[model samples]
Target: MGESLFTKVWNMHKVKTLSSGQDQLFIGLHLIHEVTSPQAFAMLKERGVKVLHPERTFATVDHIVPTKNRQRPFQDELAEKMLAALESNTTDYKISFFNLSTAYQGIVHIIGPELGLTQPGMTIACGDSHTATHGAFGAIAFGIGTSQVRDILATQTMAMNKSKVRRINVSGKLQKGVYAKDVILKIIEVLGVKGGIGYAYEYGGEVIENFTMEERMTVCNMSIEGGARFGYINPDQKTFDYLKGRKFAPQGEAFNRAIRFWKSLASDPDTHYDDVVNIDVSDMAPMITWGIHPGHALEVSKSIPALNRFSVDEKATAQKALEHMQLKEGQSLLGQKISVAFIGSCTNGRISDLREAAQFIKGKKVHKDVFAFVVPGSVQVKKQAEEEGLDKIFEAAGFSWRGAGCSICLGMNDDQLVGDQVCASSSNRNYIGRQGSPTGRTLLMSPAMVAAAAVKGELVDLREVI
Candidate 1:
C-alpha cells in the first residue's frame, strides 16, 4: 500500500524519535507575529540563545494592529509594546520582518503563501492556531504554543506526536450560492467539533480538486475548529501555477526542478489512510452558525436545533449557548435581525472573497440601521482590491473599507462589536465573547452571505439577492 502525504512529509522532516515517543521534527518555515513572539523572544533572551535559523523564520504584525488609524504609538499600550518587541527581536536575529511600512505585511498566513514562502512537502509552524492555513499548499503546518515557539526559535525543531490520517472526500458539484466556507462549516457540523481529534484531514474529491487555491486555503484555515491539527490537499498544476513568479518562488531551471519535487509529494492513487469519509456537496446550501460554537450550525433554510435533539452529554452546553445567544429553540435563523456585518478574516479576507462580495453587493446599499465593513487579509490583497475598484464598490454601498489586518476577527484590536449586538461575520469562530463583548453575538457565514445580511439588515438567502 502507498503512504499518505502526511506520512511522507513527516518522515522527510523527522529529525529523531525522542525518548518520550514524540518525533523531533525540523520546521521548514517558522512564522511569528506580535501577539505571541514577544514571550518567546524574551525566553530566548533569558536563555542567552539566538535563533537557530533566522533565515527560515519570518515575522509580521496582524492580530493587534489597528485597521482604521494605524499610526505608531498604538492606542493600546500593550499592543504597541508587543510590536516594538517583535521589531527589535527580528532585527537582532537578522530575520525577515514584514513591518506595517512594507506592502508584504498582513496576516501571517496570508503573507506566507503570497510571497511563496509556504510550499509543498514542507513543515510549517506558527504561534497562531490558524497556521493550518498554510496546509492548503500541500504542506504539514500546525500551530504551537509560546513555549513551543521558543523551542523552534532556539533549535529549529520541535517535538510532536504522529497523528492518524483521515481522507475527507467531498465529491460532486456545489450548488449556486454555496461556497468553500459553507462546505467547511458542513464538514465541521457533520464530523462534530471533536471528530477530527488525533487526525490529519486530507481533503480531496472532485469538489476540492476543482476549487481555486484561495478556496482551498479557506477550507484548511478552519481545520483547527474541527479539532484537526492540520489539513491539506494534494499539490497539482494549480499549486505550481499559483506559486510560479511569486517573490520567493524558484525561477528558470530551478522552477522546473521545484515543480517536479512538488508533484512527487502528491499521494499515490492507492495511498491508504487510517480512515476515510465521503461527502457529496451537489445539493448543499449556504450554511450559518446559529449557536456559539462552529458545530452548532445548519443550512440557511433549516431551523435551529432544539435542545431535545442533542444527546444527553450535549444538552447542558446546548442550553448554555441558547441562553447566551438569547435565541429560542427551533427558531429558524433566516430573517434574524443583525446590527453589524463584517467581511474579513484569515478565512475569507482574500481578494477573491472581497471581489465576490463586491460583485454581489454592487449598486446595492447597506441597510439604514446596520453597520457594515470590509477588511482585506493582506496589504497585497488590499492593493489588488483597490486596483480592481472593489474598494469603491463597497464604499459606495455604505460599507467601511478598512486596511489589511485581522481586525474584528478576534477583537484583539480596536475593531470589536458593541454590547448584545448580533453580527453577520465572515470570520471563523462564533464562540461567545469572540468579538469582544461578552454579550455580542456572531453569526458565521460566507462573505456573500454577510453582504446579503448587511443589505437586508437580517439573515437572508444570498441566492435571492444575487
Candidate 2:
C-alpha cells in the first residue's frame, strides 16, 4: 500500500530518533507572533543561544496589538512590552519581522500563506493554535507551545511523536450559502470534538479538491477544534497557482521546477489510512456554535441539543455549555440577540472573507442594537479591501472598519465583549471567556453569517439574507 502524505512528509523531515523515543523533525518554516514569542526569546537570551536558521523563521505582531489606534508604544503596557521584545529579539537574531508599518503585517497564519512562505511538502510550526491554517497548502503544520517555540528557535528542530492518519472525504457540491466554515463545522459535529486525538486529518474528495486556497485555509484552521494535532489537503493546481508569484516562492525557471516537486508531494491514489470519514456537502447548511465548545453547534434552523441528547459521557459538558450560554434545552439558536459582530481573525480574516461579508451586507444597515466591526487580516488585506470599496460597504452599513491584527478574535487586545453580550464572531474559538469578558458569549460562524446576524439582530439564515 502507498504511504499517506503525513507519513511521507514526516519521514522526509525526520532529522533523527531521539533518546526519548520521539522523532526529531526539522521544521521547514517557523512562524512567530508577539504573544508567544516574548518569553521564548527571553529564554534564548538567558541561555546565550541564537536562532539556528533565521532565514527559515518569520516574525509578526498580531495577538495583542490594538486594531483601532495602532501607534508606537501601545496603550496596553504589556502589549507594548511584548512588541518591543519581539522587535529587539528579531533584530538580534536577524530574523525577518513584519512590523505594523509593513504592508505584510497581519495574523501569523494569514501572513504566512499570503506571502507564500507556507508551501507544499514542508513542515510548518507556529506559536499559535491555529497554525494548522497553513496546512491548506498541503504542508504538515501544527501549533507549538512556548517551550517548543524555544526549541525550534534554538535548534530549528523539535521532537514529536507520530500520529495516525485519518482521511476525511467531503464529496458532492456545496449548496449556495454553504461555505468552507460550514463544512468544517459539520465534520466536527459528526466526528465529535475529540475524535481526532492521536490522528492527523487528511481532507480530500471532490469538494475539498475544488476549494479555493482561502476556503481550504478555513477548513484546516479549525483542525485543532476537532482534537487533531494537524490537518492538511494534498497539493494541487490551486496550491501551485497561489504560490506562483509569492515573494518567497520560486521565480522564472525555478518556478516550473518547484511545481514539479510540489505535485509529487501529493498522496498516492491508493494511500493507506488508519481511518476514513465521508461527508456530503449537498446536505450541509451554514453552521453556528450555540455553546462554548466548537463541537457544540447546530444548523441555524436546528434547536440546541438537550443534555440527554448527547452521549452519557458528553452530558455534563453539554449542560455546562448550555448554562454558560444562557440557552435552554431544545431552544432554537435563531433569534438570539447579539451585541457585537466581529469579522476578522486568522480563521476568517482573509480578503476573500471580508469581500464575502461585504457582498451580502452592502446597502444593508446593521441592527440598531448590534455593534459591528470589520478588521482586515493584514495591512495588505486592509488596503485591498479599500481598493475594492469593501471598506466603504462595511462602513456605510455601520460596521466599524478597524486596522489589522488579531482584533476581537482571541480578545487579547482592546477589542472585547461585555458581560453576557452575545457576539457573532468569525474567529476560531467560542469557549467561555475567550472573547475577554468572563461571561461574554461567542457564536462562531462565517463572516457572511455574522453580518447577517448583525443585520437581523438574530441568527438569521444566510440563505435569507443573501
Candidate 3:
C-alpha cells in the first residue's frame, strides 16, 4: 500500500524507537517566541546543557508585544522581561533572533514561511499551539510544551507517538461570499471539536487545491482548534512557486535538486488513509461562531440552535454560551450589535486578507460607534500592505492601522475588548477571556465579513454589503 504524506515525512525524520514505545524524531526546525521560551531556557540553564543545533533554531517576539506605541521597555513589565530573556538567550546561544528592529520581526509563524525557513519534508516544532500553520507547506509541524522545548533545545529530538492520518477532502468550488475561514469553520462544526483527536489531517480535493497559499495557511492554522495535533496539504506547483527566490530557499542548481525532492515528498496517487471525510463546499456560506468554542458555530444565515437540538450533556454548555453572548436560542445572529471589529492574526493577517478587506471597505466608513483596526502579520507583510496602499484604505475607513504583532488574538497584549462588548473578529479562538475581558464576546469570521460588521456595526452578510 502507498503511504500518505504524513507517513513519508514522519518516517524520514524518525531517529529511533524509544523503550516507551514512542519515536525519537529529529526536528528540522525549532521556532520559539517570547511567552513560552523563558522557562525552557531556564531549564536548560539548570541542566547546564547547550543547544545541540542552534543554527536550526529561530526566535522572535510576538505574543506579548504591544501592537501600538511599541517603545522600548514595554508598558507590561512581565512582557518586557520575557522579551529581554529571549534576547539574552538567543544572543548567548547563537540562535537567529528576529527582534522588533529587524525587518523579519513579526509572528513566528508568519516570518518562518516568508523567509523560506518552513519547507516541505521537514519536521517543525514551536512553543506555540498554532505551529501547525507551517503544515501548509507539507511539513509535519506541531506545538510543544516548555519541557518539550527544553528537550529539543538540549538534544534536537523529541519523543512523539505516531498518529493516524485522516484524509479531509473538500470538493466543489466555494460560493462568492464564502472564504477559507468559512470552510474551516464549517469543517470544525461538522467534525466536532474532539473528532480529530489523535490524528493528523491531510487536506485535499478541488477546494483546497485551488486555494492560495495564504488561504491554505489559514485553514491549517486552525488544525489545533479542531483537536488535531497537525494538518498538511501536499506540495505542488503553487508551493514551489511561493518558495522560489525566498531568502532561505535554495539557489541555482541546488534549487532544481530541492524541487525534485519536494515533489517526491507528495503522497502517492493511491495513498491510503486510516479514514476519509468528504465535504462539498459548493453550497457552503460564510460562517461565524455563536458560542465560545470554535465548534459552536453556524452559517451566517442560520439561527442559534435551540437547546433541545443539542445532546443532553451539551445543553448546559450551550445555555452558558447563550448567557455569556447575550444571545437567544432560535435567534439569527444577523443585526447583532458589535462594538469592535478586528482584522489581524496569524490566521488571517496576510497580504491577501488585507487586500480583500481593503477592496471591500474602500468606499465605506466604519460605523460611528464601532472601533475597528487592522494589523499585518509581519513587518514584511506590513511593508507590502503599505506599498499596495491597503493601510491608507483602512485608515480612511476609520480602521486603526497598527504595527505587526499577535494583537487581540489573545489576552496577552494591550489590544483587547472592554466590558461585555461584542466584537466581530477575523482572529481565531472565541473562548471566554480570549480577548482580554472575561465578559468580552468574540464572533470569529472572515476578514471581509469582519469588514462588513465594522461598517454596519452589526452582524450582516458580506454578500449583501458587496
Give the poorly placed runs of model 1, Cα more than 4 Å off.
Answer: none
Question: How many pairs of residues collide in each model?
Answer: 0, 0, 0
User: What are the models' TM-scores?
Assistant: 0.99, 0.99, 0.99
1-466: candidate 3 lDDT, tens digit per residue = 8888899999999999999999999999999999889899999999899999999999999888898988999998988989999999999999999999999999999999999999999999999989999999999999999999999999999999999999999999788889999999998998988888999999999999999998999999999889998999999999999999999988889999999999999989898898999999888779999998998989999999889999886789899999999889999999999999999999999999999999999979999999999989999999999999999999999999998999999968899899999989998899998999999999999999999999999999887778
Model 2, 1-466: lDDT tens digits are 8888889899999999999999999999999988888899889889999889999999999988898899988888989999998999899999999999898999898889989899998899998888888999999999999999999999999999989999999998887888899999989999889999999999999999999999999999999999998999999998998998988988999999988888888888888899999888786778999888999877887888767789988898888998899989999987888989999998899999998999999889999999999989998899999999999999999999999999887889999998889999998899999999999999999999999999998888888767
Error of 1 at 198 (Å): 0.4
| lDDT per residue (tens digit) for residues 405-456 in model 1 | 9998899999999999999999999999999888999999999999999999
lDDT of each: 0.93, 0.91, 0.93
Worst 10 residues of 1 by lDDT: 457-466
Give the Cα error of residue 97 in candidate 2, in Å. Answer: 0.3
Off by over 4 Å in 2: none
The local lDDT score (0 to 100) that residue 81 gets in candidate 1 is: 89
